[model samples]
Target: MKKIVSFTIMAVLIMGAAVMNGDYVSAASVDGLNDKINELEKKKDKIDEKQGKLSDKQKNTEEKMAKNKDKQAKVNNEINSIDQKLTKTRNKIQAKESEITETNQEIESLTGQIKSMKKKIENLKKEIKVLKERIEQREKLLKDRLRAIQSNGGSMRYIEVILGSQSFGDFISRSTAVNTIMDQDEDIMQTHMAEKREVQNKKSEVVNKKKQIEQKKKEVEQKKASLQNQKQDLESLTSKLNNQMSEKEQLMGELKEEHQKMEKYKMSVAEKQQALSDQAAVIAEAKEKASSEKERLKQLAEKREREAKQQKENSSSTSGSGSAAPSSSGGASTASSGGSGIFIWPASGSVSSGYGGRDLGYHYGIDLAPGYGAPVHAAASGVVTRSAVSSSYGNVIYIYHPQYDKSTVYAHLSSRSVSLGQSVSTGQTIGAVGNTGNSYGAHLHFEVHEGPWNYHSGINPFPYLP
Candidate 1:
């Protein structure tokens, strides 16, 4: 894969150097540094916005929780009130049942009394009718007797019945007898009529009483039915209130969890803020130094390349030209010829360390781990880039290949076999191997480049190498 390391290396190398110290200007001047600082401030503003959004979410969650709590409290009250009403209604229903029982007994008693009154009224009416018939029969008999007397030359008149009687004593006797009979008949009839009236009156009064009791019973029943309905309503309300309480409990639990999350986020933001502060300071400083040192580094590279070319020309004078192995891999033909744009293999070894991900400090090169001091070949000949010793990556060599107008870097070299600007072949020996800066053992740290040692602009070597 191509080493994806492209950078304005000539400038950024100088920035890295300045950052090691506080007061150095790099390839990009102080104006550039201020601009970078402004950029960092913009990042801080974004972080603030993010923190505000989280805080707002926390507040909104809390407000919702509070409302749910209030609703729960009201629900609880309703539940309690409903329970009370249910108890009262149940008691009322029981009381109504007892009243209904008593009212039923009273109605039964009134019915029996009416039955007895009906029997008595029937007997009295029969007696009154008999008495009326007796009076009519007696009147007819008296009229017949009076007619017989009148035909037998006897007359009965109001005066005869009084003064024209055979004697005043006889008239008094006749009047007494008539008056007595009339009195007895009237007495019988009056007693019988009076009894009937009394019975009828009693029956009417009893029926009215029964009706009154029934109406009272209906009212009581209606009230009881109302109470029962109220009781059912209360029960339903109580159940709803209970559910509300349960929901409130759940909301409270959620609220607690939310509060905890808010705290955790706040702590995380604080830590992130501190990290950002440190990073800004470091990047600003590094950005400055990286600019200047990178240029000097490139200049040093050009110097080495000129020297390597001279070495190659001198070697051709002494030994004609070194014959390389035939190109075995397809498309690897005539890779190095007269420096007319062909890249030589800098070393003979297996290629390694392809590149891509940007998170780790980027690697702009390939690593070729070979047996110690195995001949390092020039890959598709070009002038040498540089050979140096340093930190992180030590004993490094840079080669500017002619084919693609690209530079290649080799590090951790045990020894160098060429000078700067030295032209080499596709498989010319360039260096040996040894353990160098930040190296575990003898190996070749190789790289390809476009212009110089800008680590940012390089692609992985795996895709490009033959």
Candidate 2:
């Protein structure tokens, strides 16, 4: 009877020890889950901080882009104005050239006229010399006639000469000769006076014509000089305008380059923001799961403790309550299995192009034809690895599933609802599909990767989709 009583006590102690061991295991599990949840929460907070900085950067970049566009417009206007000025100046220069050409022709004609007038003056001088010689000869002849008349007692000589005739015919001839001598002397004086007057008129005409031609030439020369000055001014203006245009073009080029850089930077910030958002989402999901697990463990620990107490009490009375622990373990296994490796359709669309060779190059993703602004959802519960714009991709999103070692990409989105590092659930609306990047129309370019998300790391997404 003593041995039987000892065996009963030993069995009771063993049962008590097992109950305590089970309670310790449950409490430890709860503590571990709580610690994991705390770690995930911390990670989410860090991601949030990073996302805030990226958002600020994106805002600043957008502002810069706006200012750059404005500056570019202003530069373009200035360049256009400079071009107009250059055209006007060029036209003015051409007009001045025409005027100068006309003035030069006028100058040549005036020079020829001056030369002709000089030749005329020379001829007039020669004519005047011949007239003066004739006048001198005529004066000499008259003087001689006067001297002979005086030497022969003037009127008496004339009467003697007239009476010295041989017959009646001779007398008539002498009288005619005396009358012709007087008429000839009077004609010589009149001719000398007329020749002197003609010479004087010719000299006066030459002087006046020369003066007029010189004045005309002076005026024409002044006009040509004026035209030259105007042309020079126009040339200078054209040069200045060209310089201004060149400077404006250079500035515009620089501004364009800067604008491009800003766009790229803005895209990068957006991508970082998205990545952070996805990470935060993943952490939050993990925290939620850890919390749930902790609670479940706590409940299990309480249930086990109660059952242990009941078993101890029932052992004192009967023996059939040990099956409850294995049942609870099975329930925990079911819960754990419910939380992994599931995906859903990312968007509503028909596949327009499958992953393969394209016109330009190899297509890395499947193109989905959806109307603009169509809703895009997460393919699975995962962290957003990236969200941003690319020159080739436009707006895009990347979701990474750590559990499955898989990543999904959604490209050519018009707008995104979620940010970087955000956690997303399966079928959660993360963005809207639209024409973005190098796309021809509104569509979603979807990709799936078994490993890290990369351009070359993509596989055919059709096989993975439901």
What lDDT does the true structure give each of the candidates? 0.56, 0.73
Of the candidates shown, which would achieve the greatest lDDT relative to the real structure? 2
Superposition TM-score, candidate 2 onto the true structure: 0.53
lDDT of 2 by residue, 327-426 (tens): 2211111112123335566877788889898887788878888789999999876667677776668888887765455789898999988765566778
**Candidate 1 residues 358-427, lDDT tens each?**
4666666767767688777766555553444545455555665534546677778777777643556667
For model 1, give the RMSD to the true fold. 20.8
- Model 1, global lDDT: 0.56
TM-score of each: 0.29, 0.53
- Model 2 misplaced regions, further than 4 Å: 1-33, 61-102, 122-160, 237-261, 285-384, 387-466
Error of 1 at 403 (Å): 30
Which whole-number lDDT from 0 to 100 does residue 43 have in model 2? 57
